[model samples]
Target: MTPGSGLEQHPLLPWLALQHTRGIGPVRAAKLLEQLGPRWFLSPRLPDCGLSEAQLVQLLTPSWSVLEPLLEWQRQGPARHILSWDHPAYPELLKTLSGAPLLLFVEGDPDALSLPQLAVVGTRHPSYVGKENTRNLVTQLVDVGAAITSGLAIGVDGLGHQAALERGGVTLAVLGSGLEQCYPKRHRRLAGDIVDGGGALISECYPWEAPQAHHFPRRNRIISGLSLGVLVVEAAERSGSLITARFALEQGREVFAIPGAWQNPQAGGCNRLIQQGAKLVCEVNDILEELVAFSTAALKIHPPATEELLPYPDLLDNVGLETTAVDLIASRCQQPVQEVVTRLVELELAGWVESVPGGYVRARRS
Candidate 1:
């Protein structure tokens, strides 16, 4: 739903009441949402808690009792709306996660929240390879129409934001802290670029909430929940990146990990994830191929390859990935080197090939 549609005429109001009932958390909210449809949620007709006696008490007491603050927030108009549990804008990806947020306090660009997103996360201190891979991947992902989502941390996350901006693409930064104070303090510039590029900044907590260590793990769930998949560029064995990856698995979103050198400490978590069945992404195609089944953005934003590069002589298709020199290409087409070189230049301009150290490498555009 759009911003103003949060609880207006929806059955979500009573569910929000159940959430505000002082100790009732997500697990409890799920049971009650199904039980109380659009009517009064506190009705005595509800049955006994399926949870154990101890769990029952936990369910009855609203763990999230900030209903008044939340409602007051909604009263402020749609500028800062809260996406309730049943709203349509609530990501379909998030619906799969257990203990999903009963409501999400939204900030800027609510419309984009409905767009397909790919979470890009990694260590605060990424290695050279990690940074390069992230930049390239983010550019390609955005060009293919997937909005980049990251924490805007110093390393890989920062690179993702920068790449998206450089390519004139959109991005979303999920903050561990409130939007009032963009964390890392240093990334204030990068955050500006994101917003300027039509990206948004979001968090599960309220606007005044401050960043804390504990808030990060919970923030990971939102990162995973917003995207069709979580892409880990680089992460240490116990890094926050892994936490987001774990949440992706739990949320039933695909988990894609970029492989880094074994000698690098940051690659450990991603490599381990690959061992546990996460898709290993060496390049953007690996990511695109995996996401194609779920999204058609790749088919739309990605430009077609040039005629010279067509694998089967079809200008609409990519000249297959092959190993051939400019000389071979010229000879095969029966054209002069200068003529062939000009043709290749045009193809390169259209994102079909790249000049390598000794020859050209087939490149794909998104």
Candidate 2:
């Protein structure tokens, strides 16, 4: 996974060389790549660098000791490869964002990071209601075949992962900490579950980097950047969830907000997003319709299985009928209510029926 090994060029090598240099940050590294390339650290270039005369002294300074750990790291293996902006594997969506991570030290499946993604984000300290809302909506979205992405922090993020797993879908966990350490210690098991279930655990931080305060806002940007849109399930006025919404706005990705009861303090930020014109999400269809319209493709959804249903009729013939209750349908079909409920769920997912207040309504066929 050494970046650009199979390609004709490695633009990031020059950038990473500077990244390994002390006193050079993203702005400086980008400047160096534009000027002397990675050689900026080795050779001396004054005019090519935008650095003022005073800045040149600092820029020219050497810090080989700072690179000792990195050199040793490079010798280890493909299990870790540092990715810079120019790596072919670097996501195209990520390239459009400002200050994409200078290096991505990835674990699990790196390919999953490049998929067309929709980020599901919300409050880390979610209320009970918030968790349920996240689970239901995420399940619906996954059912329609959109991959779930989130910063695998606690609360709503963890719930989204669980729901996607239950729905037999893929999810990506963007970490605020390093690959080696799982934050919230409680989610160590859940993190394993995510990787075991065909998703990935991702981070840009180097090994053993702890979840510091500064890391999360930076992490928030990646959560938004990797997504076609971001769903904010719930958030307080000043919560970190707002950071992701802000990044989504700045990154030009769609920002979706789920409205909740005004009586709940946790709903404040999402309510504000709605007033400010973020989509007011009520169901997964609301999201899928918008997504399919934007992406200009039909959702890759598979129909539910027969055994998972109640052995009802060819549901198409049952279309355009009056609404019917689960209990009544069970009696009509001579099946248990649970079986009837399952069939109705399958039909509803297939878009042949819509769940009404007290019953299921058949969709009118054209």
Candidate 3:
């Protein structure tokens, strides 16, 4: 179905027009939408709609040239969709951000946006361990029913999408370039796989817009905005993933960073993030533990059916977030240490639990 099918007239034109204005941004556009309802955009009136003189004049005379082609593009693809800020289907988490996109171009399952999401991000050039960590964590995260969100760039972002799809999980790739101009051309096919796998390719730029330097950093906000938390796998001192983490902090979202080898230049950003108080994650469960509390609020809107407990739910509950030894956990669960150790490994891979220096701890709540 079309994104705005039920409406009398497509609202894409006004939403696109509002974004196209030279000086107006998401913050200003949101204000305008709040003051003048859709009728003002449809009727093109110049009333006291809280806009400055220049903005009022611009609103009165929207650039139809920029909007017309976008409308045409939307009509061409059945799965393509446009989400305006006021649309009921807009992501609630994203809508809370002052810099959230006024218009989002989606090219897959739009409902995917409403699902619980965790942003996985890192440097474009990652170490082997970084790639492994991303893939393993993404697979485990999806296994537990959480959707993965990433930028769909090279390295960590690309690995995140591939891992999610490989595990039969849903993933969302937030793009810096438009759908038509997939950045890092090497990953174009990967982009298709994401949509084909029931995931989505999202962009704030027009379909034909090319990847510009500013666009990537600007798009970082959406990555953090869409997710409950941002997880940094690996990053250099100055990397885009750090930018996303900063945005996550500003948006009141949790930030998790994986510690890498101290000497690896790629790890500088992540180490600094931990020093600055972002959660230090060693394995998948670490991320899940942080996500549970954040996701609880979103789940309340339409309470989902309770998730099926993993094997050994009782044993898992015996291990809390606090540190505990294997012997102690075994004693609490009334199981043998050998069996407990084996089960803990399984739980660690599934992201339900973690193993520490002393013993094991609950990484995710049952």
Candidate 4:
């Protein structure tokens, strides 16, 4: 039913009520559905539905206040939809996870969920090279006719969605906040662009719900659950991108990572993944090679072989894992101070060396 269409007799109002109930989570909702089926709300009493006493009351007393905004949101656009778990169009991949969302509030074409997806995730504060790598990788992935999916935050996530849109490929932005609340506020325009470009803006929260710290980690599961594989471009040792990688592993999806300069804090998690046996992706082919069974077109796309090079090979030899003074590095390399500074800048961009307070440190070379 369209939002604001008919609250009085809408078939889904009761289900919405159950969703809005304070203590009735997906597990409890599932238990109730099992006991009472689709029309579980019609049952006179909740004693046998496995709901706690307070939850039973909350469910019985439907909250029009909480349900009204959702309906209003639906009324705002024809593309918006509230998908119940039983909706035939609900994503099969997500349904396989335990305690999956009972209702998915979607904006844009829901059919995009049926297409093959690859999740690209990384840090919010990516280095310049990390951002460029993400954009290029996303472009190649889209060429193979797969929908890109990400959390839609800044850095790599936003870059992935933007690349897909620029290439006219479908992408999905799964939000940590409500569709109406668009977290970070700056991405509000980006969110609109996604829906306008035939991509999607999705949420499991109410339309007006504000973002919380916990929402993002919960949101990560959905990103991995919806995709055939996940690629971590760059992330810190303790970044949330690693959490998404863990979720992908748990969901039985392939995990891919690009090894970066060892000195890059952002590359720490990705390097660790490579050490732990995640596919070390140097090019899109590394990802496509694993996804051949998932997307036949991937086999047709011939990505160039991976290339690894040092911008200034000699400069790095003078730098070590420990910080070394600029003058000392220049003296050791036998290069002029001005030349050394220029080379250091170039090496940093190549993710080979990082400038420290006193001088520079060499990053791990893969």
TM-score of every model versus the real structure: 0.69, 0.70, 0.76, 0.74
Per-residue lDDT tens digits of candidate 4, residues 1-366? 344556666656677778878877776777777677767777765577556788777766756666677778899999999988778778988877766788888999998876789999999999999999999999998988889999989999999999999999999999999888998799889899989988888889887789999899989999998899999999999999999999999888999999999999999999999998899998988898787765675335554456867567787777889999999988999889999999889888878888889999987752
- Tens digits of per-residue lDDT, candidate 2, 1-366, equal 332335223344344444555566765565555566434545656455565555555444433443445545545645455566667777778876656777776655667777767888888788888888898888778767777899888888888988998899888888888867787789888888888787777777765688887888888898888888999999888878888989899989888999988989989999999899899998876676566645635356443334533334643344336777777777766777786778788877876688898787876531
Each model's lDDT: 0.73, 0.73, 0.84, 0.85
lDDT of 2: 0.73
Backbone collisions counted per model: 13, 0, 0, 2
Better of 2 and 4 by lDDT: 4
lDDT of 2 at 3: 26
RMSD list, candidates in order: 10.1, 12.2, 10.4, 14.3
State the lDDT at 348 in candidate 2. Answer: 79
lDDT of 3 by residue, 278-366 (tens): 99998777776666655656432233458776789778778888988888889998988899889889988888887788887778554
Estimate the TM-score for candidate 3.
Answer: 0.76
TM-score of 4: 0.74
| Error at 233, model 4, angstroms | 0.3
Q: Candidate 2 at residue 165, lDDT?
A: 86
Best by lDDT: 4
Candidate 4 Cα outliers beyond 4 Å, as residue runs: 1-9, 31-49, 297-366
Instruction: Give the worst 10-residue stretch by lDDT in candidate 4.
Output: 297-306
* Model 4: lDDT of residue 344: 88
